[model samples]
Target: MGIFDKIKEKLSHEFIDIIEWLDYTDDTICHRFERYQNEIKNNAKLIVREGQTAVFINEGQLADVFKPGTYTLSTQNLPILTTLKGWKYGFDSPFKAEVYFVNTHLFTDEKWGTKNPITLNDERFGLVEIRAFGSYAFKINDAGKFIVDIVGTDNNFTNFEINEHLKSLIATRFTDTVGEAKLPIELYAANTTELSETCKEVMQPEFNSVGISLEKFFIENVSMPEDLKKEIFEYSRLDKIDLDKLTKFKTAKAIEAAATNEGGTAGAGMGMGMGFVLAQQMGGMMAPQMGGQQQAPMQQVNTMPPPMPQAIQYFYSANGQQAGPVAFEQLKALFANRTVNKDSLIWKQGMTNWSPLLEVEELKAFLGGNTPPPLPGS
Candidate 1:
């Protein structure tokens, strides 16, 4: 109650005797401990509660960092700050320096996503564009580095500022990782967890460079354009369809459609045509096995009669040896080239022995027109 005692009490209040941060907001990443004149008394109480770190900066230079403990700030405890301040010996007076309390707790559920589509080359789909989004968790690993690199002199730093930078880093690394993986585009959605792990591994060093520890990264979804999705779905559907069954189904449908037609002659003709096509398809499907298994035929049934037993191949004498079992057309070519003349002996499958080409019945019609009278013989 004396005037001197009251003055001492007032002076103590003026100089900050306790330095701490009781964060009430969820987003704050770092909060500067505020005092009346930014001064802390010698041997002041500094409380860095669990999930927090206390850092002191001297003249804009990082000096001391205390992790998750109670400390009385002095030259011994604040050696870096004391050295930076050139305090060779401890002083009793209040000191002027910046103290920042960094939140080191795991910040969970931070969202990251591709701001733009990432273009990649897919083996099956060719060039494709896709996008992905996910959540992650991070914590401040090095309070000193974080304060110096990110917080700087900002009295209030929040998750929003850090997230903006991190998201860009993640996006860049994600694009690179995905482009290099060379995985199928469809697989991205199927293997999000795997992809997420891969991306986290690739991006960890980048996060470490900024004093943030990436604890968890998750890929919630990978998406592509609607047209691309539809195309992929259609391709899958076609691959799974049975072509023979599909042909039978269509032929039945065609028959039903032809039967339902109302036009007179045109409708009859349509029905007949459909019936003919149906017969051919059914014949191919039910054909007797050539060996034991009936291999599926890919070609349509020939409407023309079986091609005249392959036009009767023949062998002819050429270069003093039998040359070929060539068809009639090839024989004509041989004669035109003078490699086979009327004296050239020829034989076919049914012939008992070789005969002169001129004597063959099949060649007379061709030779009568093409051959000239022999020069007058002696």
Candidate 2:
């Protein structure tokens, strides 16, 4: 072969004729077509497979974008690139331009989580901190815009790079949406589906700004502090508790304790008091049940002679001296004569200390009926 023939063969070999990409790594979002200083020959065949898009950048400006299809690089098909290159007429020589293949398939299982707890104001819980995490899916929508805005000069861009940015964006938008939602803290877990949809809607515009499409968003779990969780759980049981029954249960327990400690004087006294109170309660409870039996009134009447009455004596403080123990009738006469008044200290058998006459239940009867004036000083 002649020298000219050899040079033509070398020049032909130096130009790229077929421009395509076979993506092996599923994580790759964009891969630059490696030409190694070789220019693309005129009428070069551009192969854009399914789930992929071809973007051409000329002179640092996004020029032509091709969807999944076979394309021949020409003035007709490369209108934007041709115009940017000022090629009024299509050229026959090789052209130098950047070709990038962007993955248009959904990139799923991208994780997003709040690194710090999101503070939210809840009506029942007040200010609460919660953390959330879940997976999301996305895809490149506008290849040209994506190349221009995010993947600039990135020869091989993987989802890892973009995921970090997307996760931060998702976290921010998630916090904002959750806070604005104002849902009860306890409902966050139960309503994750609704919250996820709302978060997707809120973050779609952010993704769109950079030519990405948020295909799916999810909130797998929302969690609060363990203590807060326990508190919420306990609060939920409040309506289930029967306070009256609980009080009775506590009283029964106290009585049991008093009965077990018969050795101590204090315990004995407590046992006696508890027994009296318990008897009164039992009597009150039985009254209704007995009355409901429809028994005739005569059946409840006593058939035996009544027991003799025991008189209760009283004592009074007269002129700073302890007076004799007077009968109840005599005590009433003393009160009527103004020898003792409601304020006069009095005591009775089994009484712990002297009490004001007005404070005594049995003596209160003396103050009723006709009013009597105080006697003149003798």
Candidate 3:
């Protein structure tokens, strides 16, 4: 039997007092009231709750849209339906029409993600592949158009029917937006806000055309393949680290480790082995230069560095302003010029606090002529 006939058969003895969708489902985006089989009584109360809207459709034609409020199904209130029905005066009889309730609230936390990796050409890594996942929100802006285009005349339109289509649409838009952007994959996480805004701008027109509004789009994470991520990480680490410094530190640590061993065969003895290897290499190289002469004494090849003199520097403070770590010669000039006096505070590498120059043994000679200046408070 037809839908109307089935409803008529079920409600043959009685009639609906109120025409409204009282209980709505979470998954259902729109619901066509099952009163198709029964006639809508004149002056029937139509309740449109908050975040909801009621659309009246007459025999394959869209009529008036009722926002969130109590609507009285009268000829005066429904001028479009009344005109379509060709009612000269207000008819008090029942009428046949379809009513659909649309959910217009912002649906939040809806997930959108890539199932497989999306490959992009990267400047640093050549061809790179990445996957992104995030949440989005939307609302029904045009209820009549949504009913006409998406929900249609179905008894109920739920998320199950539209989930795949929405996901596919979002993915297509994202792919287009990302491809056109040519953004580096590594920057996706950092540039999520900009990317999300761009995606929304690119997708709004298409969504609006279908009676829905793309409210908010967000990208939470963009990840590459495990191997690719590891490679990128290693590349970043290698780029930031100084190879020369690393080599020097490792060599110094190796030398320190060797010195810590007390065994007679370790430490500087390893230097003898290294010296022997170096002498063999040197002999091989010098043999060509020596023109077959008898081998020279290997003891002459021992390479030891000469020790360097220790440098002593002094720092002085005058008038609350501290001065540099000057060498001994500069200190002598400063004392000769009287830039520093006998009581001027001076300090050096091993000293605790700044001491008067007269009290320091090193400065006595530079003081010149006559008895030494008395120490302060001595």
Q: Which candidate's lDDT is highest? A: 2
Off by over 4 Å in 3: 1-14, 237-239, 243-378
Those runs of model 1 whose alpha carbons end farther than 4 Å from true positions after fitting are 1-10, 237-239, 243-378
Model 3, range 168-279, lDDT digits (tens) per residue? 8888888888888987666777898999999999989988987999899999888878887787776677767765433323333344454455356665664453344334
Taken over the whole model, the C-alpha lDDT of each candidate is 0.82, 0.85, 0.77
Colliding pairs, model 1: none
Question: Which candidate gets the maximum TM-score versus the true structure?
Answer: 2
Model 3 lDDT, full chain set: 0.77
Worst 10-residue stretch by lDDT in candidate 3? Answer: 244-253
Error of 1 at 32 (Å): 0.4
How far is 193's C-alpha from truth in model 3 (Å)?
Answer: 2.1
Clashes of 1: 0
Return the lDDT, model 2, position 43: 94
| Lowest-sum lDDT 10-residue window in model 1 | 243-252
lDDT of 1 by residue, 154-203 (tens): 99999999999999999999999998898878778999999999999999
**Clashing residue pairs found in predicted model 3:** 4-37
Better of 2 and 3 by TM-score: 2
lDDT of 1: 0.82
